[model samples]
Target chain A: MFLNLIRWFRGFVVFEIMGRFPERFINLSTRQGHFVLFSRPRKDNFTAALLLCDYRTIRPIARKSGVRLKVRERHGLPFLLGKYKARCGLLIGLLLFLIITVFMQSFVWTIEFSGLTTISQSTLKEALAEEGVFVGAFKPTLDLSAVQRKIMKNIDEVGWMSVNIIGTKAEVEVKEKELKPHILEANVPCNIKAGMDGLILSMNTKYGKAVVSSGSAVIKGSLLVSAVVENPSGDVSIVHADAKVMAQTQRTKSFVLERKGVFDKPTDEASRYRLRAFWLEFPITATSVKQSYTSRFETKSVFLNNTEMPISVTVEHCSRFSPNIYSLSQSEAQGIFAVEDYLYRLFSLSECESINAQRHYAETDSFYSMDVLYECEEDIAVYENLVVN
Target chain B: MNRKKIKSEQDKQNNSFGFNIKDAFSLKPRIEIFDNTSAVIDGSCGVLEYSETVIRVSLGELSLKLCGRGLTLKCISPTSLIVGGFIKSVEYIM
Candidate 1:
């Protein structure tokens, strides 16, 4: 194999000598410091052999030996090139394609970001693009550590990030920051005042003196706990007032429901299509209808041999919906249930201790009123800075 | 007696160099046969006769005839030739 490679590199010719005493020709050639490989007799006097020499050297030898050397085959790079010399454009194109392929392999063709929840992919991609770490960017020019530092500094939500460039794909993995819960501290001297008018159910004072006991009916903004205290020797001191006061409160609300209303109903009409391309998107199907529609998009990237490529396909499902007018009669409207739902919403909106009793009064055929008595617990302290006069 | 004495004096003079004159200058051909199937002859002059069963190569003062079945000249250079086949015998003729 090694000898054949050398022979192919230097270029050789396999020819046959058809003349008188071809054996003499071979002898003369070998005797004059020429290489004759695989020399065998053909028909009567004709001998076929492979000469491991240039054609220029063999021409003179064949002429001097008075033998006709017909080249039956030529093998080597130069001979092969000469044979395809007429189609030079095709050769150049093939060479150019190889060069372009090697050059394109040095760029990032696909960028994939994972482990993102609160932070959007587009925002991270934009940040990466600013650092010269996006698709079509040169791989060697990207400083991953610098890019990571820049992303961590620019995006406050990002806690950690890792940028890994494998071949033509860039994989960015990230973790987001977790938010801590807020805690409110009472450090200033203040009085605990009534947040609403209610009958006091219970009072538990951690600090300061309780001025109002249980079963005391107080108005809004009335002090329930005092921050100032007096000793037996006429000495006074101010302390931060802290207490939990449970109270019973009353609430009344009215809700009116109409006999008819308009509602949007989803129909079974939906259109789905796919778009596929490399680094560019071209929708293969027509656009969905211009009506109001809710759409869902799913994208899948193409990978060849476990390596992600720039080509991807996106499928879109668009569902159109129209409004439907629904009506209900007086008896079928279920006004009590609607009022109860409204009361539940109102109670959820306000902080309360507990509801004691609920009463509903039907004022008219279309009007319904509800009265809810709630037992609540709240902090009613208000602070006024000490006026030094 | 004169010729034998002259040849003995020449042999003594040649051995004075501590090596055989033909081996020191590589003036003689070296033939190596392997299991009667392949033969390599170095310092060959040229081909004398070539056929399917016999190949005669000239090596200066001596000639080597390779007798084999389906004999072929695998390689031939200026001073060496490699013959491969089912070789039967190699005869040296002066």
Candidate 2:
């Protein structure tokens, strides 16, 4: 194989010698320090031989040996190059393709993420990009340990992470931090008291004496469960009081709404689109409307397969609106039904278990005042530390 | 009697010096064949005969005849030659 390669590099030829004495031609060629690779006899004293020498050297040997030499075939790199020298563009294109293939092998092409639940993939990718580790980044310049440390430092929710780079793809594996419940101190001397004024619906005392029974009303800051216990021996000791006290509580809130106000109503809408390439943006449409309008922007980036490029198209929608003074009618303004609707929304927002509301209103010539009374079932137990003397 | 004594003395000197007389002065060819497919001749003079199935190489007083199918001289230098093909037999003719 190595000899064949050398033969190809230094050009070789296969020629046939036709003469009376072909054996003398071979002997003369070999004796003259010329390299003869293989020789085969043809029909009627013509001998074909593969010579590992330049084509120019075979003429003198064939003339001296009194034989006519005809080159049957020419093989090697020089001949191959000479045959394709006319098509210069094709050769240059082939060379460029090989160079580009080798150049592209040194950059990252894809990124894969796994074991992610809470931390977003975009957040991790953004952090990785800040540390110079992203798609299209050179692989040799990246320090995996430093990138891992930077990601961990940037995202506190990650407990442990690993960044693995394989060929043109980078795989990111992460574990999220576990959430732990808060633990309270036990065996402390404390009393459970009412945090708000409420009627006791149910009381479950675990380690204390219940001073207030079910269906009894208690005021705010009043003690419902006591930590002090007196035994038959006339000895008193303080203990931790643990209980769950469900009660019905009343909450009141009041707010006033203006009968006449100015509101903006959308009347006209227009949109403009632009393409963003790198740091420059090119407007695709010439629909720039500069007016008092509310604009909403939607950007869509181009992605080849799963890898994201830095090219995107943004569409901005502009809605032009005018403000007009809107006034309520006399009957609608004086009606208290709107306050009940707002009060129901407020009760739902507060996440009450069960609620009932009563509305009270006072109206003037221009505005109305509304007060809402909300009764809700809620847990009203507040812990108070007991002092021992 | 003098020539015999000198020959005996030369033989004794060669034995004591561990020298081979044939290796020192002989022009005999050394042929090595690998798996009956290729042959390397160390002391080739020139090509005596050329053909597809037979190749005869001259080495001073002796000639080597190689008979095979699809045989060719793979390489040839001033003093050595490599024959490659499906070699069937090799004969050294005096």
Candidate 3:
């Protein structure tokens, strides 16, 4: 039984009280009863004595005790011990596995890079690798400050980089540096003028003449938008007119659009699903196709460990074509208008008070083409100060 | 009876052993053993005339040399020496 206990401990079932066994005690099993007594004694002659006697033949040491002794008396091992030992093999296996898993998790398994533009991913990965923060390196060993310094030293384009350990994955958030724009500080004479039309609420004539007062009316190209002016008191001051003048005005714009559509392109291919470990490999054997394609294949690639591996699978899809021609449907034309509007806003073109748009011309030379005319008008300042004070 | 001869024998025993060659001259002195012998004077067999190199030996090896002083065997190697610093010169005992 003791040997079995030692074996269970060796298999890591019981770990806490392994080394606490008494050295001078021996437990023996006999036909009479189980004996647990000291194997060493204080006398110098005989080392110790360990014996067992039948319960009926030997007198009870505590005959006056109220408690009755039974052959299989409860030993009061903590109730949890038996429960723990019942499934010790599985519990111990799971516990050991959990410990090993935790050990592995404390180290880095993947290093994900985020917010990288202008600089290539491979270049950033290489820069990070030089700082000892690459894949498979221990996460605890990473000194983020040192890595930041090293990255800044190696790549001048990187303004700052933040490193964070999310469980077993290391995330490197990068921000490419912004370069200061060059400012022309020449001594050439220049001017500033009213940039927009609004009621001049406030004005300070710093180095230029105030052509229009707070309530004065100024036309779009009126002299109130001063090109050059003379101050009072006959000092002949050549003011730069480096002051803002605002007044209310109006604007108008127009656009002409002409469009056509031929046969709608046939289905190129049906969307398919392919399972891969790292999105690097795709084959048609496992991927199911539902339709056909009438267009050429376009290959898309994804990067893994600095290698650009193709992940796209192509299969030709086509449908029988009918000799048919068509015009732009209202929905398609509205979609185009939405896209045009979005592009116009994105390009920062001025808002139009009016639009004069028309279909200028259209042609069908292999593909449909359209010519659009857009016209616009707005109240803009014409007279700008061209002299410095 | 042979009292006079016994007396002479006793007298000889009272003095040091005849093998004690400490008072005798050594053809190769201690200075010669330690000196750079890449240069040797003319008429010296298998020896050089002039060189600046110095020979070195460890303390343990020197102790071995001191212990071999009483042995009547000489080493003839260029890089090794056997000093028979005791009575009489070495002879081929074999």
Candidate 4:
């Protein structure tokens, strides 16, 4: 196989020897250190292939052996180059295509991440971009080991990370650290204290000793249950204080709004598009935006034959707006206060047993203020650690 | 040659128990027949006669006649050659 390739590279000629004793020509050529391949014999003529260099020197042997040599076919690289020497542009284009394909393979085109549960992809990509592993990063210049070490060191959540640049795709695989429970256990020795100043409605003590009885008035930061239990013999035992103390609490909060409210109003809107291939971006639509405008961005990747390419299209929709002040009437001001009171109750008193609210409205020259007094019954037990040194 | 003489000659030439000059240096023709289908001959002298049903190969001291149908030389080099065909018989002619 290797000899055949060398023959094709140096060029070879298949010729026919037509004479009475062409077999003698074969014998003569073999004796003179010439390799004759694929020798096929006819009645008085035979065909065989010889290297182009040998063909030039074998004419004398063919004559001496009383045989006439006629060229049958030609092969190999020199003949091929000679046949298409006039069409230089085609060859140049073929070479240029190879050079470009090799050059383009050195840059990263696509980036993908796997094994992400708690950490967001955008946050990781931002961190990766800061570490020089983003899309369009030069593959030869990238130290993937260093990048992995740096990312694993900087990000506390990533337990294991691997970056592989295969062809044009940069695949990042990550394993996040399993999170531990943050809530404290009930077995720890602690005391239950009153969270707010209120009248104690009920007390349900599961462990330790209860210090406050039902219907007792207590202030905020007052201890409702003690972790130290003592018997009649005066022997003391420290245990975890577990109890639920329901209290009727009264609190007042003010919701204020100026008569003239300032809000951003949209004045105009504009849209533009950008095309990105690798790191180079080109604007497809004219860029238009106000000095202070909110924008929405949408990006879609380009695909060819169901495979995602490096190119993408980004559409930016900007809404131009300016701050405007409008004066509110009496009815509008009352409606706004009603909404504020409803939301405060819905969020703050959702877990209460019962709720009673009283609204007091007051208006000044510049603003409107509403004071809401709330009374609700809820569990007010809070844990306080006890140091027994 | 007769089968017994040919077998003895082959055993001596290819796998002799003692030292042999022609077998050691590969100076003479070596013929290997594969179940009568093809023959690989090392030290191929030359093609003496060619026909569709018969091929005469020179082996210096002896001439080998291969009788078959559709006989052709698969490949030929200076020292080695392979003959491929359906063989009815192989004759060692004097």
Q: Give residue A141's error in model 3 in angstroms.
A: 8.7
What candidate 2 gets wrong by more than 4 Å, as runs, is: A1-12, A28-34, A45-53, A74-77, A101-117, A120-180, A185-202, A213-223, A227-240, A246-380, A384-389, B1-25, B30-42, B52-56, B62-75, B80-94
Per-residue lDDT of candidate 4, residues B1-94 (tens digit): 5999987886767654565656668677788999877899888787777555787878888989999886767676666678787888899988
> For model 2 chain A, where is the 10-residue window of minimal lDDT?
A46-55
- Best to worst by DockQ, what's the order? 1, 2, 4, 3
Question: What is candidate 3's lDDT per residue for A173-222, written digit by digit as tens?
Answer: 98998878965333332444445444444455555455677766454344
Report the C-alpha lDDT of model 4 over A1-389, residue by residue, as the tens digit.
99889999999999988887766777678778786777776655678888898889998998898989899999999889889899988899999999999998999888889999999999889988998987788888899999999999999999999999888889899999988878757678999999999999999999879999999999999999999999889999888899989999998989998999789887688888999988899999877676688898999998877657889999888887788999988788999999988898889878888989988999999899899899999999999999878
Q: Is candidate 1 or candidate 3 better by DockQ?
A: 1
Give the TM-score comparing model 3 with the true structure, all chains together. 0.38
| lDDT scores of the candidates, listed in order | 0.76, 0.81, 0.44, 0.86
* Candidate closest to the true structure, highest lDDT: 4
- Compared with the true structure, the alpha-carbon lDDT of candidate 4 equals 0.86
Give the clashing pairs for model 2: A37-B73
Global lDDT of model 2: 0.81
Which CAPRI quality tier does the interface of model 3 achieve? incorrect
lDDT of 1 by residue, B1-94 (tens): 9999998877875776665676757667888888888999999988887778889999999999998788888888878889999999889999
Say which prediction, candidate 1 or candidate 4, comes out ahead on DockQ: 1
Lowest lDDT 10-residue stretch of candidate 3 chain A? A13-22
The DockQ values of the predictions, listed in order, are 0.50, 0.44, 0.00, 0.31
**Per-residue lDDT for A95 in model 2?**
94
| Superposition error at B54 for model 4 (Å) | 6.3
